[model samples]
Target: MTKQRSDEPEVKPFKGPAGGWGSVRSLADILPREHLGPEAYRELARQNKPDGFMCVSCAWPKPADHHPAEFCEEGAKATAWELTRLRTTPEFFAEHTLAELRGWKDYDLEQHGRLTHPMRYDPGTDKYVAVSWDEAFDEIGRELKRLDPKSVVFYSSGRTSLEASYMYGLMARMFGNQNLPDSSNMCHESTSVGLKAALGVPVGTTQLKDFKETDAIFFFGQNVGSNAPRMLHDLRDCRKRGVEIVTFNPLKERGLERFTDPQNPVEMATLKETAISTQYHQLRAGSDIAAIIGICKFLIDWDDLAKADDDLPVLDHDFIAQHTKGFDEFAAAIRKTEWADIERETGLAREELEASARIYAKAKAVMAIYGMGITQHVKGVESVRMIVNLLLLRGNVGKPGAGPTPVRGHSNVQGQRTVGITEKTELVPVEKLEAQYGFKAPREKGLDTVETCRGVIDGSVRAVVGLGGNFLRAVPETGAMEEAWPRLDVSVQIATKLNRNHLFAGRVTYLLPCLGRIEQDVQASGPQAVSTEDSTSCIHGSRGKAKPASPYLLSEPAIVAGIAKRILDDNPKVDWDGWVADYSTIRDAIEDTYPAIFKDYNKRLFTPGGVWKGNKASERIWETPSKRAEFLTPGEISATGFKDADGRYRLITLRSNDQFNTTIYGYHDRFRGIKGTRDVLLMHETDIAAAGLAEGQIVALESDAGDGVQRRRDGMIVTPYDIPRGCLGAYYPEANVLIPVEHHAEKSHVPAAKSVPVRIRP
Candidate 1:
C-alpha cells in the first residue's frame, strides 16, 4: 500500500455503538497487511491475561478474571504493529538520507518497521550510518560530560516499563541533573496538581472492583471508543446492572451513547448494542469547568432547599463535616455563581444541568471520570478541582463505588511518575538517594515540556535523550520546534521504530534500537521480567516470549545502564552492570528507594493479577497539610473562551481512532466516520453555515495568541460534525502547530491543546 492523504474530506455518519462487526472487520484487514501469523494470534490471546505481557496501548486496567480474547481493537493493532516481520535495518537507513526522510509523512516513516541496530547521524552525507552499541553509549557519555548536567533533558514516553524508567531517572539524578521530563507533561499533569490539593494523592483512588459496584459515573471530555475501547466491557456490565453513565463533551461521541460487546456472541449474532450513557451533554469547548460548576450549583442549591424544609437532605453532611474542609466557602461560591453564566458559557440550559444533578442526587455513589478534555486547558487544574468538589458534595471520595479517575493515555505513565521520573526535584528525595546509592542528588529545578521547548529555542537545553517518544511532533507549535530542534548539541533516541522526531537530527544524534515489550530480553543472569503500573495503580509483571527483532537490540534498562557506566565511572556504589544483567536487582533497588510503596516488590508483582500499590487517598489517610481533603476553588472562574470571540472558534485537538499519541496506525477513523485522512476540522453544521462556509471547504486555521508569532495550519478540510455551536475539533499533532507552548494550564503547565482560540480562513 502507498502512503497517501485524501484530496477531499470524506464524511459519513457512523450510526451504531463502537466495537461490533466494525472492529472485527478492522482486525481482519490489519492482521494480513501487517504480515502477522498464527503466532501473533496466539500472543494476542495471551495479551492482558495472567502471566502475559500487558497491552502497550491505553492504561485502562485489565479485569481480574481474564479471558482468551481479553484485548481491544487498538491493543491487537499495537501488538501486530510491534510483532511485524518487517525490519528497518542499517541498509534501509543507508539508502535514505536524513534530508529525504524529513519530507516523508509520519505514517510513512513509521510503516518502515522496527529499528534493528544502533545508528548515528552522519553530518557529512546527511544520512544515518550503523554504529556499535559501545560507540553509541560512549559518544552519549562524552557529550553529556561536555555540558552542564542540568542542561541535558531526559524524556520518557508512556511505553517505558517500570524497571527501565526507574533506572533512567536514577542515572539522571546520580549525574546531578533533575531535568527528568516524561509523557505526563503532555497529558494528565493537571490531575496531579488538582488531586494533590483535593485528595492528597495525584493518582486515582478507585480499583477495578469499584466499577462493578458504582451506581453512576460522570464522564467529562473523554471519547471512550477511540481512547480506551476495552473499557466498554465494564460499561456494558454496569449498564446491565442499571448504573447511570453521564457524559459531557464538546462532540456527540458514539461510544458514550451505546457500545456493543464484541466478545458477546449473542449480542453480535443479533447485532444488538447495549445502551451506555443515560445522559450525554454536548458542552462548549474548554467549558468543562463551567459545565461541572453548573452541576455543583444545582446540587448545592437543592441541598439548601432540603435542609430548609427539614426533609431528607441531599448533602452528605456527616461525611463533609468529618472528612472534608472549606465546604462553606466552596458552597458559597457555587451558590453565588448565577445559572445564566453557566448556561451561557457551557452552551447548555439550566434545565439540562439540573436534570443531570437529579440523577447524581438519586445515586448512592458516582465515579467522576475524565480525560485530556478536562486537563488540557488554561484552567485544567481548576476544572479537575471542580470535579473533586462535585464528588465531595456527595461523599464520593474514599468510598467503594466512587472517586476521581483520570483516563490516562499511556501504559505505565503513572508508574513512570511513581518511580522517580519527574521534573519536580522534590519528588527525587535527595537524602533517600544519598543513603541508598551514596550519591549527592541534585535538587535543582528543571524544565518541563513547555520549558524544554523554550530551552531548545533559546539554546539553554544542550542535549535531549528520549526513551521511546517523538518529542518534536508531540509538542505544541510543531512548526517552531521543527525549525529550532536541530540547534541542539546532541540527541539520543532509544526507540523500537522510526518517527518524524528522529528526523530533526541535532548537531550530533544517535538512534539506538531497543527491545520492544513483546520481545524476549535475556541477560547473562537469566530472563528479565519488567513491570508496569496500570491506571488503577496495580503493578503487573510482563515477560516477553517471542524472539527479538534483532540480536543487536538491547533492553531499555541495558541501554540506560550502558550510558550510566560511562558517565558515572567513579560511582562504584551504584551497580549499573549488575542491575542490567539481573532485572530483579533493579526491582530490589526500586524497593530500597520506595520501600513503603514497593514493599515485597518481586514476590507481590509476579502474582496472578499483580499486586495493589495501595492508594493513600482510598485508605482515608490524608497526607495533606490540612490533614483532610481540602476543597480548593479558584478565586475567579472565567467564562470567556467557552464562547466564540471575534469570530475565533475554540479549537480542541483530539486523536483519530487509528492513532495513538503521535503514532499513526492508519488513515481511517472509523468511529468518527472519517476515512483516508487526519488533516481535517470537525465543527457544528450551524457554525459552518454561520461562517458562510460549506461542509468541505479547504481552509487555514490560525491561533491568535497576540504574541506576533505566526502559528498557522493550512490545507485543513472543514468537516462539519455533531460538536457544539461555537467549538471546532481537529486531529492532534497536526493541530499542535496552532497551539503556543506558553499557552498551558496555569498550575500544571500541561499544553492547552484541548482549548486553543483559532479562526478558520479560506
Candidate 2:
C-alpha cells in the first residue's frame, strides 16, 4: 500500500557466509533501536535455559549442552522487538483513526509498540477506544450466545504455548464448535497428512541428537540460516564429523552455502566460515517430487544391477520385508519412471540426480530436512511422502541419526497441535475428552484456514477469535479477506503487538492485549511457567523473567480462561478458574488426555532440558492401519500438472531476513542483498529477458491459478538474481495476494504459496 520513497532497492552481491559478525551487528542494531536495556539482554540470555523462557522465533530444538548465549540473530531480534520500551496506549489510538492507520506499513504499525490495554473499535469515530477487560469479555460472550457455535471460527497462532492452546481448544469444543483453524494449516499440514499416511505419525522420527550421528543429510527447500539459525550449529558439527550435506532448492540460499557459528570465537574473530553443503542443486520450483523420484529411480536401478551379479544390492531388503508394506508396488512404479521425464520436470541433468543418489546410497545413516518449500505446494503431501519413501528404502527410520525431519517454523507450532489444536475432532477424540474433562467435544470435522476464509466470505462465519496470529495477513487471498472481514458480526484479537489484522475489524471488534513470551505471568496463586514442545518433541518449561509490557496485559491462558468463563457461565464440567490459577493443573489434564506421550508431564517438565516424547517410527513401531510402515506409491511425478506459459514463472512466497511470518522487522533482506524495500521480485536473468523486462522495472504479477479468477499484485520491481530460469521469488504477505485461496494442497488443504503460476506485466 505504501509506495517506495526511492527509485529501487539497493541490491549488491553478499559474499560472506551467513551469521558471524553480520548477526552480531544485527543484534546490536536492534537492541538500541528498540530501546532494549541491559535487563532485556539478560532476559534474552535466559532463552533456551533450563528455567528460562523459550525463544519466540523458530522451533529448532534447544541443545542439552547450550552456551550461555544460546539464542540466534532472529531470536535476539524477536526478544528485543517484543520487549521494546515503546507502547501503544489509548492516547496513541485516539490520535490515529482507523482510516489513517490503514495507510501505514505493517512494520510501522508494529513499531508503534505493544498494545497496552483492551481496546474496542468505535465505528462512529473510526478510532479504537480503551475498554475494560470485563466489558470486552461480556460483549464477546453476548455475541457468541446470539450466533450459532458452528458459525464462529477459532484461530490460534503457533506462538501459543501448550497450556494456552489446550485451554483454547477445550473452550471452542465446549462452545460446540470444532472450527479450530491454526497457523499449522498454512505451513506444516502437509507434513501431518503425508507422514501419517506413510509412517503412522505426523511428526518427525529423529531428534536433535540424531544430527551428530548422521552420515549424510539432504536439505530439500529449507532455508535454515534466515529461518532456524540455531540449526546451523548442528549442521556445522555434522560437517566437522565428515557428514555429507546436499541441498536442493530453486535459489542458492546463503545458509546452505556457508555458515559461521556466532558462538565460535575463533571463526568469528578470523572471519572464517564453515562450508555447510557438500553439494547444492538448483532445481526448478515445484520439481521436488520429480527430483526425489529421480533419486529413488536411480537407487532402484543401482540395486537391480548389483542383484544381477549376485552381489549385495543397494536396497535394504531385510528391513523392508520385516518392517514395511507395499515396497514391491513402490519399486515397480519407480522402475517405470523415465530419466528423460525427470530431467524435463526437474530442469536437472541425469548426472546430477545420479551423483546425489550415489552419495545417499553410500551413507549408512541419513536425515532429510525440509520446510515450507517442500510442504507448500499442490502436491506437498506427495512430496513429503517421497522423502519418507527415500528414507525407508535404506532402513533409515529406526536407526540412529537417520529419518525424516520437517523443520517447523513457529516456536510452539508443533506443540500447539500436540495439545489438541485441530479442525478434525478425531485428533482430539471426543470420547477421551469427554471422559477426561466431563464435557462433550464436537464430533464433526470443522473448517481449516482456507475453509474458514471461505466461510467468512459466504457469511456463514459470523465471529472470529484469534489467539495470537495475524490471520488476515498470513492467509492467501489477502484482498478478499480485507473485504470479507468487515462484514463479520464480531471479531476479537488476543495479541501482544498491533498487526494488520487488527485493522480488519468486524462490525463489533475488540483488541485484547496479552503478555509476551518474555513477560512475567502472575496468576492467582503465583508466577506461572508455560511449556512448549520443539520440533524434536522435547517438552521444556519457559518461565518469563521480565515484567509485563503493561499492567493491563494478561497472560494468554488468563485471556482464554476469562473468555471461556464468560461464555460457559456456570458450567461445572470445565474448571476454567482453577486452571488459570495454576498451569500445572492444565499440564495434568493434558497428561490425562494423552497419557502415552505426556506421562508424568508435570514432573518431567521441570527436569533439566525437559523430556523427550518418543516417536513410534523411530522405534520401528508403526501405528498405521497395516500395523507397519507403508510405502505409498505416488500416482505421478508431476502431480500438480501446473504448466506455466512461455513468459510466465512459478512464484514462491518467502519471508525476508528481517521478518518472521507476517511481522515485518524491517524492509531489508541482508541475505539476498535486498535493502530498503519489500516490493521487489527476485527473478532469473533469462526470465527477465523472456518477459521483456529489465532489472528495477516495476511490474505486476497476475496469478494463473486456472480457477477462472483473476488475482494480481502490482508495483513490484523485478530484480534479476540467481533463481532458477522459470521461477521467481518475492516476500510474503505482499505476494500472498497473487495466491488463490482455492489453490491448495489436496489432503492438507494448505495454500500452495510456494508454487503459484504467475505472468509478469510491465
Candidate 3:
C-alpha cells in the first residue's frame, strides 16, 4: 500500500465507470491492510444470508433471492475493519497519552483496531487503565444516582441491533430519564419529521421489489456508489428494463452516471457498464426546495391548460380527490411561484425543470430517493415535504413501486428509532411500557444531539452513556463537544473498536469493549441471534459463527443489562437477569410492546431475508388526525440555497468513497480520483477562476455566520471539479468544526452540515 499523508491530497481524473475494476482494487488493498485471511472470506459469503449477520454498513435492504456475495465494497470494508486481527488492549492505551492521541488524524487513530477490554480513564496520569465490567457498571450507576436523572444523556449509534436498541431505550426510561438520543438526529431527523407530517408515517414506503416494477426513479443528492454500492445491481437491472432515471444534484457524481457491476460475469468479462441517469440536472447546493416547486408549478400549469382546452388532465385528479387533501391551496402556492425565482435558486434554466416535470408526468410510477445531502440543511424538513408534494401531484405513492425513500445511513438507525430510542416520549408507547415494565415512563421531552452538546457546554448535562458510536466526532461544532465532553461527571461507551471518541475522556470515563456482529454471542440458553430493521422495514435475524474477538468482550445487550441491573436494583417487573441469560426473553418483551409489528417474533424473524412489516402509509391508512395525506404548504417558496455574497461560498460536506459516516475506512476516494487524502476541497473551474485561485493552491476556510466567532480550518488544498458555481465540497466530520452547533434545521434540529456558508483564504 502507498504511504500517503491525508494532508497531501493528490487528484487524478478517474475515467473508469463506478464499480468494475475500481471497486475490485479497493477491496484488494483493504483486505491485506486489515489483515483478513481465509476465515474472513467464509464470513463474507454469509453476509446478508438467511441466518448470517446483516452487513454492518448501510441499511440497504437485502433481496429475497440472496446472491452469494450480497455485500458491497463498503460492507466488505466494514466487516474487515471489524474482524481485523489487530487489537487495542489496555497496554496500547497505557503507552499513549490523551494529549498525544488527540493530535493524530481520525484514520490513524482508527487503524489501532478493535478494543479488547473494559477500561477507565486515569485523570492524574492522563491515560486509561483497564477495569473489570462489574466495577465500570457500578461506578456508572452510582454517578447516575448522584445526579438529577434529567441531567444524564443516553445515546446510541445505528450499529446497535434492534434488540439492544429497545432494551437500551427502555433501560433509560426505567432509570426515570427520557433523555434518549441516537445518530438519526444528525442525518435523517428531517425525513422522520417531514414524512410523518406529509404521509402520516416516519419510515420509507418503498421496498426492494419496488425497483423491479418502477417506471422511473428520481435521484436527489444521494450518492449511491459511495454510500450503498449494492443498490447499483438493482439499478443496473432497471436500466436494462428501460426504466427512466432522472438525477438532480450539485456534482456529476460518478455513481449517477454509469455503473459496471463487479459481480456480474457478463459485465466484468465484456468490460461494459449500464447508463444510469437519462436526465441529469446540476443544481446549486440546498436549492431542492426551489427545484421541486418549479416542477410542481409546471405540472399545475399543464393541468390548467388541459382544463381550458377540454383535453386529458395532466394531474391525477382521482387519486388526489380520493386520497389527498389541500390540493387547491397547494396549487395556489405553486401557481404564485415565479420561474425567475426557481431559475435563480436552482442554478438551472427554465427548460431543465420543465423537462424533469414532463418525464415525471409521463411515468406511471416514480420513486423519490434522497440522502443526507437534502437532510443536513436549515430547510431540510421543508425540502423533504416539497418532494412528497411532488409525489402527491401525480399520485406516485401508496403503490407497489413509488414513494419517498430516505436512503438511511447506518445498519439499524431506523430500527433503533422504531424501538423507542428517541427524545420524543410520544413516539414511545408510554401506556404499554407502564403496564409491562411496572414503571411510570417519563413524558417530558428530552434534549437531542444538538441540545445535549449545549447542555454539556452550559454545565447542565452531568453524565452520558453511549452504546457504540463516536458521538463526540459525529456532531457539529466538534470542537465544542471535545471541550465539553470532559466537563461531564461521568461518561460510558460500549463499543467494538477503538476510535477518536475515547481520547477525549470525561473526568470519570469507561470504555467497555463489546462483541462485534461477526463474533459468536453465546448466552446461558444457547447462541443468540440479534435482529435489525432495514431501510425497507424488513426485520431479520443476524447470528455470528466466528469466535469472539476477545474473551473479555461482552454483548451490547449484556452491557445495557449490566448497567440497568446496577441502577434499578429494586425493579421487580423488569427481569434484567433473565433477559441477559436468554435473548429470547428480550424478543418476547419487544413482541409484547409492539404486538402488531412483531407477531410470532421468533418464527417470522428467522425467515429468509426477513418479513416485511409494512408502514401505514404504504396501505394508504393515514394515522394523522384528519385521516388523509395532507398537502400542507411550506411557509416560504423563496431560495433555500445561500446566495453568494461578500465572497462567501456554500460548503457541501460529503463522505469520501472509502468512508462511512464519521468512520474513515481509508484515505482514498476512488470515485472522485482522490488518493491518500481527505483534506482537499472540490470546487468548480468557474468559481476557482472567479476567485483568482489556481488548482493545488493551499488555503484555509473560515465560517461566515456573522456571529463574530472565529471558526476556521487551516491547510485545505483546492481542486477544481464539476460541482456547481458558488459551491465547494469537503469531507464531513473533518469540516464539521466550521459549523456551529446551533445552525440546525428549524424543525428537526439536524445540523446543517451540508450547506455551511464559508470564505476561503489563500
Candidate 4:
C-alpha cells in the first residue's frame, strides 16, 4: 500500500441518538426532500409516450404504462438527479484546482453540478481547461496508437445506453484489448459468474408478473424497501392475498419489516405502513450456508416422517428426480451436518430452521430473492449456487413466482453486461467481428476492475477511458486504486456530473461531459432512442424527454463515436460515424454479433414493452452436461461465533438509505437516527452486554485476521439492536476502509462485505 496522508474529513459519531419509529419521522425534516412542481414534472412523468427511458438508478421493473406517481423514493431521487437544474461549466472547472477539488466530499462534488463541456487536465496549472472535442479525441487516439492494447483499460458504468455500450465494446475490441471493466464487477459479478456456472445462464428467474401470483416470498440478504421501494407494493399485495413473506438477514432492516408506500395516496394520507415480513429471521453473518443447508436437511427428515404416516409431499421429490442431479449426495452432506454445529454457526436452532422449511414446503409458489449480502463474501458464488440448489429442490425455476431472483443494484447493470460491458466475455464473436468489422480482433480475455487496478499498479496499464462511472471510489483497495489512476498516461471520462474520479488526473486527462438518460439524444441523423436490458432479461427502448443540460454536451453514443473516429482513422473497414449517426445501426451490429440473444434487436425494441431474452436454461432447462441442475455435496459448514474470545464476530457492510453504491446522495440516515454522518455500528445487545459496552459507547472495531488494513475504525457509537447475536453491521465506503482488497470471494473478485471477521472494543 502507498504511504500517504489521510486528508478525508473525520466524521464524528452522533451522540444521544433517538431510536424507534420517531427516528424515521425526524428524518423527514433533515434529509433533502422536495417534490417537483406539478407543472414542471407533469409532462415528464406522463404515462403517455414522450420517450421510453427507464429510471437509471435501480433494477426494479416498471410496467410500460405506470401512473404519474408510480415512482418510488429511490426512483424519485434517481430521476430527479438526472433532471436536476444544476450545471458545472468550464468556468467552474477553471476555478477549482484538481488538488482542491479532491478535498470536496462525494456529496459536495455531485452537488457542484453536472460537467458541461469537454475539458483537459493541465497538471502544470493543476486546473482543467475547456478543450475542443477533436483535440481531446486526437490526444486519446495518439495515446492508444502509441501503447499496446493490453496497456489500456476501458471501464464503463451501468448508466450507459445500449447503443453506446455496444459501440464502446466495439471500440475496445477494435483497439485489440478486452480490458473492459465495468460497474458489474463491484456488485453482481458473483451472481453472473456463479449462477451461470451453476445453471448455464445468469439472470433472475422471476418476472414482475410473478409477484402477483407468488404464494410465498423469501428474501435472503436483501432489503427491498430502501433498495427497491416499488417492490413493497408487490409484497404488500402478496400479504393481502395471504401470501407468506419471510426475510433472512444479519440485521433486522426496517425495509424488510414494514414500509409505508409514499406513492399510495390513501396510505400516505393516513401515514399508515404495511407489514412486509411475517417472520423475520436474523441469520448471523456468514451463517447463510449453514442455515440454508440445515433447512434442507430438516425438510428431508420431515419427508421421511410424513412418508411413515402416509402424508407425503414434504419435498418436491419428482422435480429433484427429473430435473436435477446429485441430490442424494447433497442430502447425505446435509444429514452429516451436526445440529449443534448448525446452531453454533448459523445462530439458529433446529426448530427455527424446521419452522421456516415447513412454511416453504407448504407454499405452492415461492421466489427466493437476494442481493449483495449473499454475493459479497468469500463463499458468495457457492451461496448463490446453494440458493438455486434449494429452489431446484421444489422445481422453482420454471414456475411463475417460484425461482431465483438476484435484485440488481443499478437499473442498467444487467443490460450493460448483456450488451457488452465485459472484460471476460466477448461482445461480438471473434469470427463475426473479423467478417463484419474487417479486423482480426483480440480473442484474449480482458481485465475487470480488480485486474485493471492491478495492471495499473504493476505498470502494465497506461490509459483508462471511463464511460460514466466513479471507478476509484467504487472499487476496493481505495489507496491502491487511487494511486494507480494518476500514473496512467491518459485518463478519459465521458460523464454527466463531476465526481471524485475526475480529480484523479493523469498526464493527459480529458473530461467529456455527456447527456443524461433523461435528456433527449440528438445526433447527426436525428433524435434517437437507446435500449437497456433489465434484471429479468427484458430489453426496452429508452427515450429522453428533457433537453441536453448544455448545447455542447453529447450523448454517450456520440462521445464514443468521436473517440472511435479519431482512433480508427486508418482502418477503412470500420464505420464509426455511421454507427453514431443512427443508433439503429448499432442495434443492427448487435443483432449481427449476438444473433441468439439480440435477434431482430431493432424491430423488437419498438414492440410494445420490448422483448424478453428468454433465459431458456435458467428456467431449469438444464444445459449442464448432465442436463440437470446439479446439487453440490457441500463440505461441512460452520461459522466462527462471537463466543470464540480469540476475537471473531461476523461483520456486515451495508449501504445507507440515502446512498447508492459509491455515490453518496446525502449524509443523513433517517431510519437509524444518523444525520449529517455515516459512522456507527449496530450490534446485538447480548454482544454489547458481553463486551461491557453501553448504548452510544464509542468503540474501536479490529479485524480478527490482523491483515494490517485499517483494521480498526474508532469513535463509532455502538447501538444495540435485534441483529443476530454474533454479528455486527455498518455502512459501506466508510466501512470500506476496513475491507482489504485481497479479502474477496474466491471465484468472483467480489469483496467479502457480509462475512468480514472482526472484534469490537470499548
Best prediction by lDDT: 2
Q: Model 3 clash tally?
A: 0
- Give lDDT per model, in order: 0.86, 0.89, 0.87, 0.75
- Per-residue lDDT over 1-762 for candidate 2, one digit per residue giving the tens place of the 0 to 100 score: 122233347898877789988888788777887877788978987988887888898988777788879899888889998999988899999999888989888898898889999999999999999999999989988888899999999999999999999999988888998899998999999999999989888999888889878999999989998899889988998999899999999888889989998888899889998999998999988899889899999999889999998988898999999999999999999899888989988899989998999999999999999999998999999999999999999998989999999999999999988888999866776788888767777788988999998998889999999999999999998888889999999999999988999997899999999999888889888989899999988898888989888999989998999889878757676688899999999999899888998998888775665688888889989989998899989887853548757766788898888998898888668888888788888898987887778888988999887788888889998898998888889889889889888888988999999888888876
- The digit string of per-residue lDDT tens for model 3 on 2-47 reads 3336655679889989989888888998889888779899999989
TM-score of each: 0.98, 0.98, 0.98, 0.92
Candidate 4: regions farther than 4 A off: 1-40, 43-51, 308-311, 426-428, 606-608, 636-645, 692-705, 708-715, 759-762
Quick one: RMSD of model 4?
4.4
lDDT by residue (tens digit), candidate 4, 239-260:
8789898788877677777766
Q: lDDT order of candidates, best first?
A: 2, 3, 1, 4
Displacement of residue 539 (Cα, Å) in model 2 is 0.5
Model 1 error, position 706 (Å): 1.2
